[model samples]
Target: MIKRSILAAGLATALFVAPAFADDRPPTPEERAQIEAVLAAEGFTSWDEIEWDDDGHWEVDDAVGPDGRQYDLKLDASFAIIARDPD
Candidate 1:
């Protein structure tokens, strides 16, 4: 009974954690280039805190704008700028 219980708990944990790890991979070069273009247009001189999400999109946690401000942004799978929010 204890062994069965342990197995059930393990499976539950795996199910909960699996999706959280799914988007941890880095963006491909094409995606990176696409993001670069959008950022450049927006005057983003530098960026950081990038991550890939389940929709096959990438989002920047924050970026350094040419005007000396920071902001957040997102790009769709095609590298199109989907959203932006300045900090």
Candidate 2:
């Protein structure tokens, strides 16, 4: 029935979109240390915020580098730096 189809479609949409709406959360202490180790290796002196995204990526909101410049960083699940945006 059309009603059943509509309900199924709604349920399917919710399942597909749930991850996209996942909360951005602070990294766990262990996760933070891992992320910090990566930052250190990349010459980032400090970071203001680090979030573990639902998409399996890490986001550094404000990372200060050795050169005293701030950068926004994106890292893959493996902790490899994938993108850097300087401000």
Candidate 3:
């Protein structure tokens, strides 16, 4: 009984957390370009560092902007510009 209860609790926790970890939003063209630019400036030179966040948003790690500053830009799924400097 205790094992079953623990399993059920774990399942319940997973169910609640799964969606929170899911990325359902899509990126827009401008947002894509911005992300790419950041990646390029950061010496990524590839698509390896670009990825979607759990909220269906996009993100690029160690990205450098045109201003020569490094940051992590977060974009909404719609590709709309969202948050910047997440960390």
Candidate 4:
């Protein structure tokens, strides 16, 4: 019974936590176009990954900026740069 309870608790936690990491996949074609245009306008020449986060934001990883340095960027739903972190 103790083992079963532990298993159930773990499963419950996973179920609840999963939504926080939802939409882990890449953007659709139209979404990609918009994202790419925004990146280009912001002087991001290249990016390694783009994740549509559960909070309706875009998480761009390994983005090469205008200064030719890698950065991690967070963009809001409107594709406006919200935060930038050096990678």
Candidate 5:
């Protein structure tokens, strides 16, 4: 039982600490392009600007659609599409 507890503690520590030293790299150029392409394909046209919000989220503004309707695209750190407007 003691051995199991020790092993569990070590595993938990490793799980918590490992991600701290992990890469903090930003998205690659290819990834950016892919994300842009996906947005464009979804009818977003004018990708005027992108900014990070205070909550550590990203907001892509001025994303106009083919029909000329503007939209706001929000994404998380992993570039995962979080929400869309004009639903």
Candidate 6:
């Protein structure tokens, strides 16, 4: 139905727009500390993209490892690595 299509489009647009706003705010100092811990542990130099998600987890994207591997990492509030997947 037209109503459903319109609603879907609006939802898609909101999802896309939301990240733009989220990116405007860099990681908090506490968050940066947590993220840094992960980088140090994994021997990564820096984070290409780091953001705090609604789930209270820091999602780190494109972390270049010591061996030159790109990694996407997730950390919980305590900064523990909950997930690490290759980019």
lDDT (Cα, 0-100) at 68 in candidate 6: 85
Reference-based TM-score, model 1: 0.65
Please identify which of the two predictions, 3 or 4, would achieve the higher TM-score against the true structure: 4
Q: Model 5, residue 7: displacement in angstroms?
A: 44
lDDT of model 2, residue 40: 99
Over 1-85, each residue of candidate 5 has an lDDT whose tens digit, in order, gives 9999999999999999997656343445775676687777677767766755656666777687777877778878777769877
**Candidate 4, which segments miss by more than 4 Å at Cα?**
1-23
- Specify the highest-lDDT model's number: 2
Q: CA shift at 19, candidate 5, in angstroms?
A: 23
Worst 10 residues of 2 by lDDT: 19-28
lDDT for 38 in candidate 1 is: 81
Candidate 4 lDDT, tens digit per residue, 1-87?
999999999999999998766757688889888989999998989998898887778899999999999999998888889999998
Supply every candidate's count of residue pairs whose N, Cα or C atoms clash at under 3 angstroms: 0, 0, 4, 0, 0, 0
**TM-scores for candidates 1 onward, in order:** 0.65, 0.71, 0.44, 0.71, 0.50, 0.62
- Measured with C-alpha atoms, the lDDT of residue 6 in candidate 3 is 100
Candidate 2 C-alpha lDDT tens digits along 2-77 = 9999999999999999977696888889988899999999899988889987777899988998899999999998
For candidate 3, write residues 16-69 as lDDT tens digits: 998875654444677668766555655644332567766456876655555655
Off by over 4 Å in 2: 1-21
Select the stronger candidate by TM-score from 1 and 4. Answer: 4
Q: After superposition on all CA atoms, how large is the RMSD of candidate 6?
A: 6.6
